[model samples]
Target: MKRLSLITIIILLPVIICAYTYTVKQDGTGDFTTIYDAFTCYDVQQNGGIIYVFPGVYENVPLFQVTPNSVNIQIIGTNKTTCIIDADYAFYGFEIYNVNSNLTIKNFTVQDASIAGFRINSGSYGNTIIENNNITNCGFQANASVQKSALICHGNALIKGNTFIDNYNNWDYWAHEEFSLGGAIYIDYHDASVTDGLIEITNNDFIGNFARDCGAIFATSNQVISISGNYFEGNGLLESTINNNVPQYCVIARFEDCNIVDFNSNICYNNESYEVQMGPSHEQQGLVFKDCTVAQIRNNTINQNLDLSATEGIKGIMINATNDEGAYNIINNIVFYNWDGINCMNDDYGSLNIDYNDIHNNPPAGGNNNYVNVTQGEHDILYYPDLDPLTFQPIWNSSTKSRCIDAGVPNLFDDDNTPSDIGAVCAIKHRIDVVDLPSPSVDNGLKWLSFPSLDDVYSTSSYDPDKAGDLLFDILFPFEDPELEYVKHENNYFVRQWQGNWQGTSNIFSKTNGYIFQMNEAATLEISGFKVSDNTHIKLDGNSYENWIGYWLEETQTLSDAFGDEWNTGNIYSIQHQDWSAYYSEGTWKYKTS
Candidate 1:
C-alpha cells in the first residue's frame, strides 16, 4: 500500500466522509419517493453511493442527469420484474454522457421508452456495467429513419447478462444518407479511442428486435469489440420490403471498421428474412463484418429453418474484408439449415482463414463455393449435426459419436477439459411440463403449504448481498406477489418453529425455523434462489403446533436420534397424507416409513 502525504489525506477526508446511499421507495419509507428524485439528490450527485430502488413502479420518470466528476454511482433495483421503470412514452430510461465516473445499472424492467431505454454516450467508464436488466419495447414504434435504439454506447462499456426484446423501429422512410440502426443495441464508438474493449457485449439475449439495419447490435469501432456467449434469436424481420435498391438490410449483428473483433460462442437461431431477389445485397443471417483489421469468429451456432420463399440470399456468416493486412479466422462454427453458409466477400484484400467448421444442409451448405470444404483436419465438414428436435441442442449418439462433439479445433479444451464441441457448447436441456394447481384440493379444499425450497434461502446479487442467509419478508414474499391474506401467505407470524419469538414488528425473517403459508384457492408463485449450505444452530419452541421441521443435515439421521436431545412429542404430518406421520407417545418413538 502506498502511503499518502498529510496534505493528500487532508484533501481527501471530506470526499471520503460524504458518500451516501439513497433509497427510493414509493411507500414513503425511503430517502426519496421517485427514482428521478433519488438520483438527482445533491448528496448522490456529488458523492456517489448506491441508489437502491425498492420494489415498486417508478412511472413517468425522465432522465436523472449524471453530474460529471462525481464518485462512482450505482443505481440498483430490488427485483427485475417488480422494480419497474415504466417510461410511459415520456423519455429515455436513463443516460450518462461524457463522464469518467464508473456507473452501474442493474436489475430493472424498463418498459415503453418512447425514445430509447439506456444510452451511455462517450467516456472511458471502463468499469461501467449494465447487467441483468429487462429492456423491452423501448424504441420508436413508428417513425422516420433516425438513430433510435434500445441501448446506444459511445464509450467502452460492459453490456452483459441482459434481455433485450422487441425494441423495434417500423420505419417506412425513403432511403436517406443515414439509416435507422440497431434495434436492441448500437455500439456507436467510431474511432473514439483505440483502447481495447471499452464496449464489451457478452452473455446477453437479444430476441425479436427489428430495425432497418443491424436488427440486434451494430458496432463501428476502432477498439477491440468482443461479442461472446450471447443468444440472438428471432431478431430482424422474416418479411423483407420490396425495395429495388434500399442500401439497408437486416442482420443480427454488423461490425464495421473495428480494429479487432472477437465473436464466439453465440447462438443465432431462426433469424431470417425472405427478401426478394435484387441487385442490391442484403444480409439475412447471423452476422456481417466489414473492414475489420482482425476478426476471430469462432464456436458460433447459426441455424435457420430455411424459408422456401427465401430468394435473394440467406447466409449464415457474411463478411466484407477489404483491408489487405486484415486477418479473419473463421473457424470452429456450426452453420446449418440455411440457404447458404459462409459468404466471404472481397477477400482478395484480406487473408481469410476458414477451417474446422461443421457447415452442412444448405441449399448448398458447409461452404457456399459444395457449400463446404469437405477436406479433413483444418477444413470444413459437409455432414448433418444430429440435434434433438424439441430442444435444438446437439445429441450424443451411442454408435458413431456425433460429428459436432469433437469437431472443433484441437487443443482448445472445454470446461470439462475435453476437446471442445463444434456448435455453441450445447447440452440437452430437460424440460418439465407446466403443472397447474387444482384451484382447490379436491379432498379437503386447503391451499397454502410451504416453500418449494427446503433449506435456508439466501440473497441474490440483484438483491442485497448483505442479507446472505437471511430471508426477509420483502425478499421472499415480495409485496408485489400479492400478500392478499391466506393466499400468498396465511398470516404474518413469519416463523413458527424457532424457540424465541422473532421481532414480529421488525423486518427480520427467522432463518432457523420452517414456516406455514395459505394459498388462495390456488395461485401460481415462483420461488427459486440460492441456498445456504453451512450448518445453522436452530432453537426450537418444542410446541406441537409451533414446529414445521426440515431435514437440514447432509447425512440422513433418525428423527428420534436427531431431536432426542430436546423434549419432543409431536406428530409430523405432510400434505401427502395428513394422518401419516412420525409420532411419539407412551415413551416410544414411532416412524411412518415412506
Candidate 2:
C-alpha cells in the first residue's frame, strides 16, 4: 500500500512542473509572442531546459538581454532557413553578454545586421558554439575601424562550418583608395580590457567579398587566431570601380600580436595582392604580424585566376616579416604567372627555405616582369634556372615553361621531407638535354648536367596545377630561351686551342676556343680563332721566350721552320713582316744565320 502511494506522488510531479513552465510562440499559445520575450521570464535551473523557437521571422527590436547565471539557453530551431532572426540596423544580430558556461547557438540564419552577425562582447567563462549558420550581408554598412568579421566575439569562441560572404565597407565607399577588404569572417582581439581571446576559424568557405585592403578576411588584435582547411577566392574588388570615394586594397590575413596564426591546407585565388599579408604598416598594431613566431603556412595554392589590373601588381602569393624574425615554414604551394610567385622579406638571420614551388611566368612579357625578386639583407638562397652569370642566358621570357626548367639545385627536388617545388608547383623534367659545360669530366658530380626537354617548354592543354591536385601541366610548359634560334647538328667535331704553328689536316672545325696544332717537323701552325701577332700569343714549352731565331716566336726553330729565315734577320714578329727579330723580343736572344 505504501509503494502505491509513492508512485502516485511521482506521477503528480509532472502536472505541477508543467503548470509553472513557460512557452514562447508567435501564435500566442503562451504568455510571450517571441523567443526574446522569455529572457527576463526564465529563471536559473540546475539542469537548464530547452526554449523551442517556432518557424517565423523574429524581428529582435528593442533588444533583449540575458543576465548572468542564465545557463543552458538552448533555442532549438525547426530549420535554419525558415527560422530567421533579422536584426536590421542593430550593432549585432545576436548579442550574448554575462552568460554562464555551455551556451550553444546553432541551426539558425542571421542576416542583414548592421554590425556583426553574432557578437559576444563581455561574456566570461562560457563555451560558445556557433555552427551551421548562413551569415550574409551583416556588416554591409559598418565602420572601417570596428568592422572586422561576419561573426565576431571577444570571448573564447568556436566558429566553424559557417559561411561568411561579402562583409564589405559600405560607409567608406568613396574612400576606395584606402586599404580595406574581407568577405566572410574577421576576428579581432580585445586589448583595452584585460582578457585573452582564443578562437578557431576552420572549415569555412569565403567567396566574393570586397575590402580594398583585406578582400577576404582581415584579422587583427591581441588574441590567438587559428585558421585551417578554408577556401578563399574572388575577394579582391576594384576600388575605383566601386566608387571614387571607395577605399581599395585587399589582403587575406592582416594581424598583430598575442598568439598563433597557423594556415594549413588552404586555397586562395583571384585576390589582388597576396593570400596572407602581415605587418603593422597596414595597421597601427604594436605586436603586428610578429605575434605568431613559428608560422606553419603549408599545402596551399595561391593562383591568379582572373587578373583585373593591366600591370598585374602582385599576381601570386607573398610573405613579409617586416619587423620580427622566426621560423616560417612555407611549403608545398603552386604559385604561377603573376608578377612574382613568392616574395619573402625576412629582416633577420633566420633561414627561409622556399622549396618545391611551381614558380613561372613572372614578367610574361618576354623581356622583364615575371621572376622572384629578393631584397638585400635577407640571408636566403634563390634557386632558379641556369644563368650564364656573364651573358644571363635563357631568361624564361615570361612563359609557364621554358628551357630554364630543372635548372635549380637538383638536390632540393625530393631530398628533404618537405614539399619538392619552389613557389607553388613542383617542376618535373619532361625531356633531358645535356647542359653546355666549359669542360667535361668523368666525375660530373650529377650537378653539371641539366636535361632540357621539349615537353617542358609548353604547358598541358587542360591541366591546372592549382586545381584538381594534378601537376601534369607544370611539367609540360616549354622552357626555351626566346632570344635563341633552333639549330640542327649533323656530326661531332673537336676544336683545338692553339694560335700559331705549322699544320697538317684541315679537319678541325673553328669554334669559340679553337686553335691550330703543329703536325710534324716542317709544321706551320695556322691559328684561325684570333688575329696574328698583337691580339694573339705563341709560346714554345709554354713560356713567352725571346725570339732566338725567328721574329716573335719564343724559339727561332719554330719561326725558321715557318719563314725559312735566320733568327737575326727574319721579320717574323714584325707588324708588317712575320719573321723580323727586331719586332720580336729585341736584343734578348742570340741569333745566327744558317
Candidate 3:
C-alpha cells in the first residue's frame, strides 16, 4: 500500500492546476464576461491556451483573428445545446486567418451571418478539426457581381459530423444561383493548381441550401477529396422562377487538373438535377478520370425526386481519360438503380467497364439505335451474360426473370473480388470470386491474363506480398490459375514471380501501377494466404531499372511511390499506366529506367 501511494503521488505531481486556463461565462463573471469578451481578453500576445465559452448566446461579434502560433484555441461548450456563436452583428462570422495548427471548435450553434457562418481564410496545413457544430441560416450571393461561400475554405480543411442548414443561396433573382456553392463543403487547391492537398467531408447533413454552380461540396483545380456518407435533401439550384438556369447536381467535379473525388456509401435522393456530374465541359474535352481515380459507386440507394421539369436521375458524361484514352481514363460501376439510370459515351479504347447493373427503361438501346453513339476513335464495349443477339431490354419487369442472376462476368467487374454478386448489393456476408492472372518467365517479358474473378468461388490475392507486408496495395496479383472451389479466404493468397520474360493480351494487366507482372506465362507459380491492400508496399524489387519495370501505370496514374513507400495507400504512392518498361534476368527483378 505504501509503494502504490508513492507511485500515485509521482504520477499526480506533474498535474498542475493550469492557472492560465481562461474561462468565460455568458452572465459576465469568471475570467471574462461575455463570450466575445473572453475571446478578446485572451491576448493572442499573452494568454495562450484553452478559451472555454460557457453556455450562452454570443450574438454579433467577430470573435477572434487567430494569430500565428499564439495558442491552441479550443472553444468548448458545457453541452451542444448551451453553446452558440451568433453572427447577429458581423457581416461574416468567425473568420480564422494566419494561425498555427491544433484549432478545435466543437459543439457550437453558429448561425445568421451576412456572408459565411465559418470562414477559413488561410492557416498552416496542420490539424483543423470542426465537429458537432450546427451552422445554418448563413447566406451567400448568387449573382455574377458578388461571390460568397457559407463555409469558405482557402486551404486544407477537414469538416465532419456537422449539420449545415439553410446556408448559401441568399439571391432569389440571379439567373444562375447555386444553393450549396461549395456543395456544403468546398475546396480549391493551392493557387488553384494541382499541388496535392487533402480535403475530407464526411457524415454530414446538408438540407435546403442552394448553389447555382458546381458541387454542393465543390472544389476546384488540383485537390484530392472524399465526400462520403452524406445526406443531401432538397439540395441543388432552386429554379423557383424561370430564368432558365436552375442548379445542376448534388455533386460536381470540373476542370480538375489532378485530383480524386470518392463518393461512397452515400444516400442521395430528391435533388433538382442529376445526383453527380463530372466533365471538362459538355463536349468532354479535357477530362481525365484515371490513376488518381476509382469511384466505388456501389451499394448506393440513388432514388430520383427530380422536379421532372428540371433534371433526370443520374447522368455521368466525359469521364475524362482525354489524355491517354485507354490508360488515363477508366470509369467502372456496378450501379443498382430503382428509377432512371446512368448513361455515358461508349469508348472501348478508353478501357471502361460497366457490369452487373439492374438497368431498366433505357430508350434507344439494343436495336439498330444503340443508346450510345460511338465516335471514330472510341472503344465502347459491353460485356455481360447476354443472349448475344444484342437484345436490349431483354430483362424487363414481367419477362425479365433475373437473367443476369449468377450469369455475369464478376471477374471483370470487381478486379478486387470484393463482392461475389453480379450487381451492387448490401448484404455484407456474401461470397467473393477468385482473382487469377497469367504467368511470366525468362522467355517472355511479363503478363497477367486477368483477375479471373468471374467463376463462383473464393480464391486468393492477385499479387505476391513482399517480406514487409501484402503485395501491391491497390491490386493483389493472383496466386493460382483458377481455384474453381469456394475458399473463404482464397483471394488472400499471393506470391512474387521471379525475373522472367512474359507475354499476353493488354487487358491481362492492371492500369493502376505502371509495372506489369508476368501474365499467361508457360510456367506456373502458386501462392496462398497472402494479403494485399494498404499493407505490403511491393514493387519490382531492385534499382537495376528506372521508371521501366515490367509495365507502366495508366496515364491518369498519379501515384508518387509505385512500391507503397508511404505508410498509407491513398495519400502516398500511386501506380500509373499499363506498359512494360523493364525485363528480368541475372536472378533478380530488373527495370528499364530509360
Q: Return the top candidate by TM-score.
A: 1
Model 3 lDDT tens row, 1-594: 455444444345565655256777866676876655655553632454566778888775444444444455566666667787788835556766554545666788887776677777553444466777887777554443434556776666678888877765444555445433553555555554436666677777777665654434556534556666666565554432444333544333332333556654454445444332443222111112333333334333333334443323333323433444342222222222212344343333335454434333221132221223422113222333222122211222222222333333444433334433233223222223343433334324344322211111222344222211222222323434321111111122123333331111112222222333433433333222212222233354333333322222447753334433442422322222234333334433344442
TM-score, every prediction: 0.63, 0.52, 0.52
Q: Tell me the tens digit of each residue's lDDT in model 2 across 1-594.
A: 555544444344444443133456788876567766665554623345556666777774232345445455555556888878787766667776656645556667787776667776544456577777777777665345465446666667777777767666344554333323344555555565545666777777777666555555666555556677666665654343443333433355555443456665566655544322333222111011333445656545554533534344444444456545555655554444345555543445244555444444543443143333543223222334332223222233224433323433345453322213332222342223223222113222111111111222233545322121122112112222111111111211111222341121123221112221111111111111111233133332213333222123346446445444344553334422222322446644443331
Give all candidates' CA lDDT scores: 0.64, 0.46, 0.44
Give the Å error, residue 266, model 2: 1.4
Please give the distance, in angstroms, between residue 340's alpha carbon in candidate 2 and its true position after superposition: 2.9
Better of 1 and 2 by lDDT: 1
Worst ten in a row by lDDT for model 1 = 428-437
Cα deviation at 350, candidate 2, in Å, is 5.1
Error of 2 at 366 (Å): 6.8
In candidate 2, how many Å is residue 365 off?
6.0
RMSD of each: 19.9, 24.9, 17.3
* Candidate 2: residue 202 Cα off by (Å): 1.1
Clashes of each: 11, 81, 79
Off by over 4 Å in 1: 1-20, 59-70, 175-177, 192-194, 238-247, 275-285, 308-313, 364-377, 389-392, 397-400, 426-594
lDDT of 1 by residue, 219-244 (tens): 88777778899998877742223333
